[model samples]
Target: MTSEELNSNTTSKTQDNALGPAVQLTDEELSANPEYVLEQTLSTILSRPVVCDEESDVDQETNALFTDDDDGDNADGNQRTSNENNRHKQSDSPQTGLSRWKPTLHKPAPSIYILCSLMSVKVLAENLVLGVITDLTLAKIQKYYEDNERQSQKEFAKFQSVTSVIQGLLGISLCSKYGHLSDNHGRVFVLQICGLLTILGSLANLYIYKDSTTYEFYSFVFFYCIEALNAGQMSMVAVGNSYVSDIVSEDNRMVCISFFMSIMYATIGIGPLVGSFLVKIFKGNSFNTLYVALFLNVSYTLGVEFFLSESRTVNERRESQSQYHNEVLRKNLRKEQAIFSKESSKWSKVYHLLKMDTLIDLFKPLKTLWVPKTALGSLVPRINVLILVIIEMFVGGSVEGSVQAIVTYSMFKYSWSSVEIGYYYSISGVGRALVLLLAVPQLISFLKRRNYVALPDSIDRIDMIHLYLFLIFVITAFASMIVYETNDIGSYLNSLFISLSAFALPTVQNGVIKYASKKSIGQVFAAMAVLRHLMSLIAPPLYLQVYAATAKTFPTLFLYIPIILSALSLVLLQFVKIVKDHDMLRRQSEASFNNFDEHINNYSVNTKPNTSFDIANNLKNGKSNLQSNSIPIETTPLFKKSHFTGKDNIRNSYKSLRNSFVNSNTPSSKNSSLDKLKAQNFSAFNVPPSV
Candidate 1:
């Protein structure tokens, strides 16, 4: 009846769909026809229609529909339907040796989307205000309409370009740091910090330039500081994606992320409209609009600080576990510190900081290649995978860069005003948002139902994204060439292209984030953010240069640049092969560790050192070393009566065995931890056969 009620029913339907045919099949019937039952279960679970040969026995429900027709005609109808179903289930069995890559995530609660909505509103307002700032303050912004070759226009352009580059440079180091920090600390904490800093920087900018008559390099300093401290828009997008990754399952992840991104675009679409409304209300006073945006940003930060529930309150590695496990880990870690570092004080913060051992921390993620449970191994089959992903983002960035160039083209080619550009941007945003929110999910669902695509074991649901990207870019590029001649129709088509991009871009980015574990999502997103910022540094300058060079002579051919970049991205995507499943490797590692731990634990309990013969002989030989009061034999809790003999080394034996058992259970480990424990500790305890 209501949207909430509709959502509830829809969620129930999906949940119901996930169950296999066991609910419908009787135990006696299943036992009598096990193969048929298996087939039915597989069909239900895989969401494929029933597939059976015409000669095969039909269940009564299936035969009922065809009862109205002749038996021969009914059989023919059934045959066609069954054949199509059969075609869909070719890769359903594991013996087929392949299925697509889609890494599962821990399902988070519903409150996260509310958080996304808040952040999106903040971003929409923030970016909209930033976009209008240069328009409001730069002297050349108005002069572009009056003078064809204005000196003031060139100076303003130079200033904007230089500052954009500087801001990008400033974001690079800090963006990477945020990723690593979020991974180590927690995503929500870093996100809140980023939000706070962004508000501070924006407020500082307002303080500097609120009443200023003109833009200056000094005014740009506040913006640069924002980029350096907060990582600008990249921080929000990166950490926001990380937050989503923490909660959504693999099945729903792509759609959920798209939905999240759509909300961002949707809100961003609303931002300029709101700003434009404000401008009209104040009779086009852009100065007051900037301060209003600053005040709104401050409110968003306070909202984030108070309202956002942390996605990872415990250590991210143990986020899936209950609070009890988190306490257990902390307790174990404390015990380990107390035992290992005898001289170190328990409360020594300086000593703990010194002991963090960050020498190889930057390269710590690379160690994940050895962990088979994770998707990282398959995600990066070769260095080429990383290269392909980065190149794809780079090309995508370059194509998106055309939007800004188009604004300038609207000024130069169509003589459109800033207000018109704002309107055009809003329209494009809506188109993009619609495609992401409505169209893309429908497409995925349509394909998912048919099950026609043979997704590789290491690839994801939308692996075709890069291939489609090549087409989208080429189309957009071709459209851009004729946009000047085509007028309104051309502009609408270009907006459509941007909308198609909104639908497609998240799929490509999802491929990268999907491979990362919940713990590493922040780091992966951070890498993406850094790449995006790096691309931002390159794309804008390059696009402007190309536009400036070709504006009068052949503005139509300007679309070819993005086409070439997209073509290169497609080529890069082709070389990136999906690797074999590495999750099995992780499972095997877990099994081995479990086995090794069990064996050691059993050995500690079951081992009985036969010092009895040696002790009896020592006593028989008139208390050689056993009767020596100086040689105190410390007791093993399990082997209390067991005594030292020969050289009175029982204390050494107990200490080594205690060290072995205690150290093995510590959370972190060196390479070959089990093997080293076996060799060093087990050997010390496993008494010589000669004895």
Candidate 2:
């Protein structure tokens, strides 16, 4: 019978069995058979004949079945399939195609790099502006209250405390809102908005000084907004950090993150120094001096937005989806695409892409830490989190809190102009930047090398790195305390100690994060944030209370907290050993292949022969190299094949062998030919342990 007649009879038989009614077989049904399916589908979809020897019998029948009326639907499917095939082809094409568009060394796209550098500048500018203005305003207000006969000193003290409390609350609220907005919008956009608000608020403060009575109420409002803007600036920092994390890979994160932080702290030091100089320039006209800061703030924001490329691809994709949604036809088209793409749904693609799972993942570390360990493996990650949290709390309470208190205290006690204060801060900034840029990379490289030598097969070396960081913090804290307490010390000596302390922080912070369990990175970070905010909340009130108690005596009561916090941190450093033990045991259990010696010996001996013959044999035989090597020893099959077989039997036997080779080759083709050969070779050389 002809191929068409055989196909028609098969379709009739299938219909009789299934539906009890004979039905004519369409070209689609004839093409669905295993031998012709792939070729027929490719030809119909690509609008070209698919070269395949196996499909020769059905090709004539398929061509005859294609009519003018069906050509439209076929053409549409073919166009779609062609577009998809082109995309696949493009992706599979060599990297050489992209080489022409690759950035040259000389004509680099330095905007992103420039933006990264400016982040340090922003950190310094924001803190400096906040410090100088807050300090100067509070000082002037205190002096006014003390000199005025209308206001009691006691009442003034209460008013100052209340104002600070109100400012703190405003800061918290604004920071939280800014974080939410940053997630919804983007880091650059939110930062720009905050910058504009800062400029407007500063200008308002300037106007209030010129027309004190008319703008009195508005001035207070502007100052309140400025406090909120300052808090919003903190959110910008968190956004910047999140953005950096998104762009940087985990392996090289420490050095990059340390550089980022070093620049920020260095800027922090420089900002106040510059502000102090500006204060002298404006000479008691604090409001006028702030205008210069306002200008810098606005310019920084504009520079960032215009120059800094968006780091989040998911955010960019969501934006595209939103823009596409605006057109009714495109929205429907997307819905259809969603139906075909099983991986993502229409609504979910937008929502999932926009959601920052990294931020959400921050909470996981905390949950992992809190869970009771069922085994030694479980205990290590949890203990690591505990150690990291302790470290974060100690540093957060001491360095971060003390810096804020000192800046405020110095402005009040020394009567130093903002310009003088800014100079000292700038020195500190320069020192911090130099230390972080120079020291951190060397430290990380040393730690990596040490890990290789000490524990070649350990995943727990990250924990040892964390332990080393704790030791560094301990030394930094001691040096800082000694420098601050020694009155005979030169200004440069004190500055040197402070800069060293700032430099140690990034290494310590990055170390804790690097060693942290992956699932809980976000939560651990959030918990660290909570610890920081809590300390921030407490430090101000404690400083104020100490100042109140020691008003007539030494103003050094404010410095007492850093010294005490430093001592407490040293006490916590002892717990690092407990974490180290847990890490070692965990790594031992997780080590998959303990018989490294035998595997190495076998691997070396088999290397050459395995490469030459094993892969080629496996490819030709259509059998995995891991399977039995013994060929089938069938005596009857030799004589049976030697005699002349029926035409049907010969055709069937040849068809079976062809199908097996085609099926075997098709899946392996998904990977590169070289990779497939390597995999086959490796499997052949490594014998599985006998059951």
Query: Which candidate leads the pack in TM-score?
Result: 1
- Candidate 1 lDDT tens digits, 110-153: 36666776687577657666656666546334443454457667
lDDT of 2 by residue, 129-159 (tens): 6655565555545455665645545544554
Q: Give the clash count for model 1.
A: 7
What TM-score would each prediction reach against the true structure? Answer: 0.62, 0.55
Question: Once superposed on the true structure, which residue ranges of model 2 sit more than 4 Å away at CA?
Answer: 1-112, 124-146, 149-167, 174-185, 213-222, 227-233, 279-286, 315-379, 403-429, 446-498, 508-530, 543-691
Q: Candidate 2, which ten residues in sequence have the lowest lDDT sum? A: 14-23
Q: Each prediction's Cα lDDT score?
A: 0.54, 0.46
Give candidate 2's whole-model lDDT: 0.46
lDDT, residue 438, model 1? 92
